[model samples]
Target: MPLGRAGAPVDWLVVGLGNPGAEYVGTRHNVGFAVAGVLADRWSLPKPKSRYRGLVSEGRTGPGGPRVALLLPQTHMNDAGASVG
Candidate 1:
């Protein structure tokens, strides 16, 4: 449950914002989710799970890769604070 924070020990913080559910898939609004998926696949990371009021996937780039977390907020576009907070 490592989140991105200023002056923290995180290598990088990648955030992908989008609506939840299968219905929004492929739509322009869901580009964030799509990008996150691509990154996860490219990095061979595990499936995202529920966390921080959103779906989160945590993994390293490789055996000794830098730590990273992929976050997709389930809340609406306007109320993304819940996920970040």
Candidate 2:
């Protein structure tokens, strides 16, 4: 299994559900995605790359905090599980 900076397996999987399109940016529907972006920045994770049909970022919470995996599905909210699964 992939380990975090603290050498621990990922302890959290944060999924941010939203639609994909420029029109949705900054809208209430994209709140989840927005929050995910904030967390990714706060954690200093690498820029999310395409994976599992979504954007993904992985890193630790802090020096010795829990490892986290963040996902922002590229699919619509109803189909977000497709990317997650």
Candidate 3:
């Protein structure tokens, strides 16, 4: 991994809290997921891929931008910490 000119690792960790699977999609409890999706679009991020025990998308804040890693845990919301760790 490369560090940005900011002098440290310039990265963003955007985590969306929600239950796994289709039944949870668009539900009120998953608002964070919705927000993350919006951010991914706004940032022109790649679609989510399975990694780090979650679904992830990678993007940059702008051209020559800071790195961003958007994460949606596959575990239940209550277990999000496991995926994060």
**Whose TM-score is higher: candidate 1's or candidate 2's?**
2
Per-residue accuracy of model 3 over 1-85 as CA lDDT, tens digit each: 3322334453778888888888988898888889988899999988788877888887697799779878898889889998877
Q: In terms of lDDT, which candidate is strongest?
A: 2
Model 2 segments more than 4 A misplaced:
1-8
Best-first order by TM-score: 2, 3, 1
| Alpha-carbon lDDT of model 2 | 0.86
lDDT of 1 by residue, 1-85 (tens): 3473343354656789888778888899899888989999988978788888898777777788898888889897788888877
Task: Give per-candidate clash totals.
Answer: 0, 0, 0
Which candidate number would show the highest TM-score if scored against the true structure? 2
Error of 2 at 13 (Å): 0.3
- Each model's C-alpha lDDT? 0.80, 0.86, 0.80
- Badly placed stretches (over 4 Å) of model 1 are 4-9
Q: Could you give the candidate ranking by lDDT, starting with the highest?
A: 2, 3, 1
RMSD for each of the candidates: 3.6, 2.9, 4.0
- Evaluation by lDDT, superior candidate among 1 and 2: 2
